[model samples]
Target: MLGRIAPNLLIRIAGRTTEAGIPPFVDLLRIAELSGNLPATDPSSTPAALLTRFPHLAEVTFEDVVVPGPHGPVRARTYRPPHPNGIGLVWVHGGAFIGGDLDRADAHWPSLEFAHRGIRVVSLDYRHAVRGVHYPVPSDDVLAGWRWAASHARELGVAPGALHLGGSSIGGNLAAGVAKRLRDSRPGTDTIPAGLVLVTPFLHPFGAPWPTGMLERMRAATTNAVVSPEDLTHMAWNYAGRRSVLDDPYAFPANGDLTGLPPTLVITEEIDTIRTSGEDFAERLRAADVPAVVRMTPGAAHSSMSRPAEPTAQVTLDAVAEHLLGRWSPRAA
Candidate 1:
């Protein structure tokens, strides 16, 4: 019966009848509907198509570079500003470890936005689980990209040791894992990044217990359409490939040590299931004497960053820019 009904019509009906208010942007519902109508195909091809469909920014310049990944050569796209600021950001795209590419709307737009603000953005096209790859492999690819950017910083016109790392969704998981690796590699050296920018990062795949009121607010924020526990479990299994490795700190950052990470900025949305994990990670960093902050976007859902023009997305972008540019204070958010 549900399959027989139109997606838009179903969305409208749910909006009208549901106790939870409608999601902030009607465009989000439209996107969901459109996605449901698309043919089942290779997830790898989706990002290029999405980039073509959402070609909004034109001021930023982009160049493709191939980095030597652990498995093979990984393609990365660098977004550059007209004027340089001497700071670089290495970004990872999110796709539940099965999908996603550098050209994804969420990844592209944020990189463009940051580039426009004078930060050099390098977005990595890491190996995905769908391609028969699994944990550590994906993270390894991301770490390779980071190292490439760091080593090539002078050529990229970015100052050495001024590189920051970030990602959204699963990309966030990779970024956090990479940061941990860098932290542990050299005990006394300043191998850590300048900072970390995590946007609605999926740091924890396993659901954590949240307060009743917080859960209700998240449900209302997402209109009860967030990722279900079953989907999370499947995604975890697919990415890890083995149940025993799920607890590996690098694979699931929630299980990792939080000490010695650089100053971190964790941005989350009110309605997303990942919000709790991101917030909890920030708390863990603070407890470990790391400078960490959490910025919560009100009434936003997961992947809201994909809709760059939305108010919530705009606010999140501004917060990220301010934090990276050293204008944001921990007490301010």
Candidate 2:
């Protein structure tokens, strides 16, 4: 009976012990199943609810779509701009591979922002690696949504070859895996995404090694920034459901060859323990001759993208929007 852990709940409760006598821990997925007052994952919000939170999005058209996933019908939310930019993004939200949904801030806030920037965004409500679901299922849902968007680009107003794939945290791992799968499956086809965006992603099974003295520096900054290596391994193993899946390139892109992957942008939180994983992946992509860029959000923690009202969060997303727009029209941006 693993209780649902809300996004960023670990950070909120950091250093606070439960009445059950369990030691204070910062890992959300490893929390003990408690009976009362436990935080729950948010349900998908209606358009009215969304607008109440973001009145500026009143002009942005939102549509709820049902895409055919291999497992079954996958629900998705589409954000349409009042003015189209001919660019589109199929985005995934993060929750350490277990918690989160379309209502999560990481999903809808960024989707609304990208749409406001004139890039049509389709945010997927992919299955989580919980309740007996494991690797390949969530990635498969994203693949199905991508294919659906690519096939209907004309009606969707997204230019051919202008669509990008991206995600944050575990969602980033799934997006990258699906990108690799597309490249391998199509070989020479143009069905792959034109680019990829990974924000504070957890790429490796045990997380990447921190720079010399970096761990000390991060701890001094904030305890909330520290995600232990054991926790990373636990999350990965939980998502995999078996040791062998950890070695599967498609399951964790850090273990795979990234030679032919699309241009990539890896955004990291300055004080987060998982920052190195995203940074290391960027270096690996560059070593493989792929165009990869890494940007660190100043004074931020992991999952900061979920707080849209925060200045640091605004700065991070503005950078993401700039990258997408610049890639499409360099002269205009």
Candidate 3:
């Protein structure tokens, strides 16, 4: 028994074991294998398949629009609420930089929820890092989509300067990049979004050290079992394409200047590795004198907000709706 247990002890000593807090519903989803591997070649991972899987989209009122980008035209879906609050949200979907689309379940569910709450949501089907496309391609597409949303706010019936930007996972990183570009651009060139909502955002592709206790627990969590450190490194390479680009603020929002960013809300998962980075990003925003708040959903894993049935997920979505409606208070629970 000692011989058999010695290797296990050694593995733990090597810090290869983590204690992720996986909820029952998430466990039933069996996301471990799916998260561990990139779905670049999987047909089911395509955007079309995502839309087909979620057939209730017709229940909501939405329109598909084409936005012009540097490389080409990018498609985006706009969901309208029956009672408009005059606020708009530009959402981007996550796929580890290589997969995912506007129709992604994670993006769809939240968009519908927000739209129903009276905030118009524009989900961008930005370019991904596939077929030789990488880095700036996706980021540029997101920027174009944002500009279109802002410029056409009048026609869309959304109030100017009331538009908000957001994304999940890598999508969060792209949204942050777009916000930064808007802030850095010539004054009055574009309308800056009133706020940002980052859900379990992948902000630090280059890596950041987590606090000791948090790191140990995050590593031990089963919720993180699907994604290994190697997988993250691989995804980063796919997005950046070159090592030099890794340092680019657009590629890693954590490295960018956080000053002048609009009021921001960063939502993180308690058991996810990216939580540390997301929290740190929020801290940076505060340090830069930007109004920022960070909230963690206990017992939640990466992308848990996509689950509409989960109470914590509902809380997360409600928080987002509040933020978009300009009612989010940093001191509120």
Best by lDDT: 2
Cα-lDDT of candidate 1: 0.75
Q: Point out where model 3 deviates above 4 Å.
A: 1-59, 212-216, 219-226, 331-333
lDDT of 3: 0.74
Candidate 2 clashing pairs, residues 3+ apart or interchain: none
In model 1, state the lDDT of residue 268: 90
Q: After superposing candidate 1 on the true structure, give the runs of residues whose Cα lies further than 4 Å from its correct spot.
A: 1-56, 186-190, 213-224, 330-333
Tell me the TM-score of each prediction against the true structure. 0.81, 0.85, 0.80
Task: Give the alpha carbon lDDT tens digit for every residue of 133-223 in model 3.
Answer: 7789999999999999998898887886778999988889999988998899999898898889999898887455666676556566643
lDDT of 2 at 92: 92
Residues 264-306, candidate 2, lDDT per residue (tens digit)? 9888999788999999999999889888888899988786777
- lDDT string for model 1 (1-333, tens) is 333345455556445533343222232233334442212222322445534644544667899989998789988998888777988899887766665566666677788878888898999988767545678898999989988988878888888677899998888899998998888886754356888989888777585556667656566555445654545666677778888778888898878689878889999987877788898999998999888899888888886776654568788888888887778666454
Point out the worst 10-residue segment of candidate 1 by lDDT: 36-45
TM-score attained by model 3: 0.80
User: Candidate 2, overall lDDT?
Assistant: 0.79
lDDT of 3 at 315: 73
